[model samples]
Target: MKNRNDKQGNLPPEIPHKKRFIIFLSVFAFLSVAVLIRYAVLMLRPADTENTGNTKPFVERGPILDRNGRILALQTRLGNITVWRPDIIDRDVLSRDLAPILQIPAETIDARIESSSADFIYLKKQVEQSTLREIENLKAEGRLRGVGVEAIVGRIYPEKRLASQIIGFVGNENNNGLAGIEYALESELSPASVKAKGGSGNQVFLTIDSNVQHILEEIGERIRRESRAEAVMFMAMDPRTGDILGSASLPNFDPNDINSSDDISRMDRPAIWAYEPGSVFKVFSMSALMESGSVNSGTVFVCDGHYERISNRGERVVINCLGAHGRVTIRDIIIKSCNAGAAYAADRLGADAFNELLQNYGFGARTGAGNPGETVGYLSPTSRWSERSKPTIAMGQEIAVSALQMVQAASAVANDGVLVPPRIVSRIVSPKGETIRSYEAPEGRGQSRRILKAETARAMRSYMVDVTSDIGTGWRANIRDLSLAVKTGTAQLIDPKTNAYSPTDFIASCIALLPAESPSLILYLAIIKPKGDSYLGGRIAAPPIREAAEALVDYLGIPRGRNPQISHPGSVSLPLPISPVVDAVVPNLEGYSKRELLPMLLREDLHIEISGDGWVRRQAPPPGSPLNSDTVIILELE
Candidate 1:
């Protein structure tokens, strides 16, 4: 070294300078490596960012409509109030501001904000648009912190409880189908909506006619009021096609608020509940005999109003009838509703043959009507049948059937022995308005079993008509201008504990086909546990059938009376009586009490105006005229 002291005093040597440069290069390399490693780590990490900030919240579901294009169920957008705890600036202030507006307690808001476990929470769900707008105004002014709105889809029912049991309701989470048509057509009714845009969806079409449904409901309500029944179920269908036109079960609830209703209220009774069909089963019994080639419509039997059987166990079963008929033909049996005659026919057909007929009619099997909770009614197996079973079943005792099954079976008679399946949904359309699928009327699905001949059906229909005419038990069911064929049934409900009929408890029912010659509509009515005067089907159920028929005839515009040109010359013509003419001064019944005006109007034969419950207030054709007996005066009251 030239001189260590001299080099130290002046500057660093050449070798020391080279060493410092090496140290600088090494530090630069280490820094570059560290930066590269950090870059790789960030690229490899999973993207788990919260989706709370996503613009669209929920996807829309499909719409369900009735046959006439009336919307039954649909989806609509609703707002929800959400909160971000971390962004909240003044928790105490926010709590007080939102408590009353959101209907939430102040303490609840405070606790939610203090919860470090949750990044966000909901303040309220499905708030109305108006209410949400008010909250948004507050949020914009900074009075509320971390609060935002999200749009969500919810199910809506326009007609409330009109067809709740058929249309069904939806669940909250994701708007899934819950019951009725919703459950039956879940996949179709709940199709995926357009990609996250929350747009409208596909449409599902049903076969129910809302007008016919209204008529049925009105008739059922009237029956409930008149009979004071525990419950009433009325159903009408095209018996040839198995297309249910109208169906109603009393004590119905609105599906929009289905959660508030009891489970029993939601149960669809027509497809779910099974009951003894009473004498209505006699139609099937008579058909079974005719189908077996063992009996004809002219076949006669004696009925002493009781049927007795000696069982294999030495037990005697005594079955009582409604009345005594000395000798009755098959037609007469149907007319009088003779239980003994029906039991005798069952005895002639024998147990195995009769059971086969019952099974053929879909009594023990599901109707496959695409309904939820369909019941397979009671029918004893061939091996388990007892001697008493035959007689009891003959009079509609030992077997049970759902209302749907009864209607489906009757469809055979109405369709010339061709059995068709029943369905509610008519077609399903995609969101783009393309038809995806359609459900046709129930056909036998390749099963070639024929129950009755066309001729037999015609004969049976003729006999059923007599049941509604002057000489039958169901005379009350007669419609003035329409030919109605109906059968009335009054079955005694057996107490399960005693295995005997209860005197006071009865199930009154009627099954009818209108325009008997070429029936288009078939109706069935059942009133359970009616409380008022009579328990007979004629008195309790027949009038409802008449009312329903009258409404339907007026609605459908079915031509009244047969072709006049085809009438027989010697047909027993009844003379129409003409009322006597009255010429008198019209009475000023206005402002007069109904109690005071009744006697004066009746004595003078002058038309009177009566309005309010208390008294008449105003009248037309004022107080005097040579009043035409046929003219009716107008009245107004307060």
Candidate 2:
């Protein structure tokens, strides 16, 4: 003990001192390196800021923003309130204390605690920070016990029902996306930079504009109410860039109350529901027919209310038209929406060639709109066509399509034959505003796609203009002097029971391209099973779209090609759809536009309080209120 140096000199001869020293140095170096790496990992890991025995604060999931940086979906500061069974002494007292704050019944909370499934259960999930703080303070002060808050991310849709179907909603309190854009962009939306830290996740920028989305929702809701249809599908797109301005399907559910909604109510119809498109198919078929040189602008055919054809299989096919189209050119066929004429035109292109053309036109496939559960649509091979299948499909029947596919196909016509793939999210940005990734199309518009010739697309657009003209079937779609190329359609719904078309059910639809000279926006609208007085596409589907598009033009500040002196230049107010007065004596104000009624707003006899902005969707006093002093009229606009 007195001399350690003397003890080392007396060590066993079998073990060399230098060798032992070398081994000890090597072991020390390895341990030192391992410790340094572990320290670095601990230092670099995300720091949890909450001090109340919680690992992290809520709001780790990134925010979803619209094209202009408006928030759509995001995470809020809320934590899951859980109960530890062992810590809980009196279940009744705990439940009673939480009932008022959590907005849950005491019985429910008590029952959950009593359940034998798990020792611990969430008393309330996703409670605001303020509420959780109060509960924690009470627990710390001995006023409460057993209750704990687990800081976890909570998904919030700020816009409520606006674009709800498109943005979708998360499931439970896990913040896991269950459908739509939420599911489609989970990787981008989920936290990657931090395991469970606030404000560390990336943000997704969509091509949608909140303003545009609100307008579409309003118009689609109005159309649904007027038509008494099951639902309406509406889409708006910037053809040049493949930017989806709006995708709406009504009736939609509010994301804030996701559990209350059904699958049918939350469906993204434009991408999910595929049905026969009726006359809207003519746009694609006619474009293909013209693009293939099978039919030219000058090509003419006579219609006598019927089309007769014989297939290679010795099968005869007969098709009926809405009316006799007489001698018509390609323009006339579209303007009049002549089903027989369209079938004839498709017949001229031959089954194989026409089918190929339509397939290339973006039908029979998904439009790549980036929404989950997108349907590719159904298109039977030409080889499988029956004697009548060709003509039926030619007229927009015997085939299935989604609204997204239709709008994407129509973009080719609007963009001068360029087939830009439809997309929702345009770019992703980090929390610090750094660009992570971008999905926008390149500078050159016509990059890898030319589904139609420039001239052919132009010709098709021109024909659509006639569709909204006075002489065309889409007269209801026409806005006075508004430059728009549009086509309207009405298709019978097929009965699942009989495998035949339902006589009482129909789908009314229309597609429009604004500023017809050089198109910019492509708007498509469709109503399913309209029960309104007029089931025609021109009647039920066109008017609401026309109104919606006009509102869009105003909000977007899209430049009109015409003179500068004009204000509200595109359209005159639409005439009333129904008779305004009950007795036809009160001077009906039912069908007048807001601009047309501004003069009446000055009248003292009638005190009219307008409820909303946009076209007059409804009116009070039955439009027949007797004219008198102090007569208050309530007008509702969409």
TM-score winner among the candidates?
2
Model 1 regions more than 4 Å off: 1-57, 79-151, 192-201, 311-315, 443-449, 496-499, 562-638
lDDT by residue (234-314, candidate 1, tens digit) is: 998887667787878776788766657987667788888898989887877787678787678667788887777666789
* lDDT per residue (tens digit) for residues 314-387 in model 2: 77788989889788788778888887888888777678888888889778888777899999889999889877
CA RMSD per model (angstroms)? 14.5, 14.1
**TM-scores, each model vs. reference:** 0.70, 0.72
* Angstrom error at residue 350, model 1: 2.0
Q: What is the lDDT of residue 176 in candidate 1?
A: 72
TM-score (C-alpha, index-matched) for candidate 2: 0.72
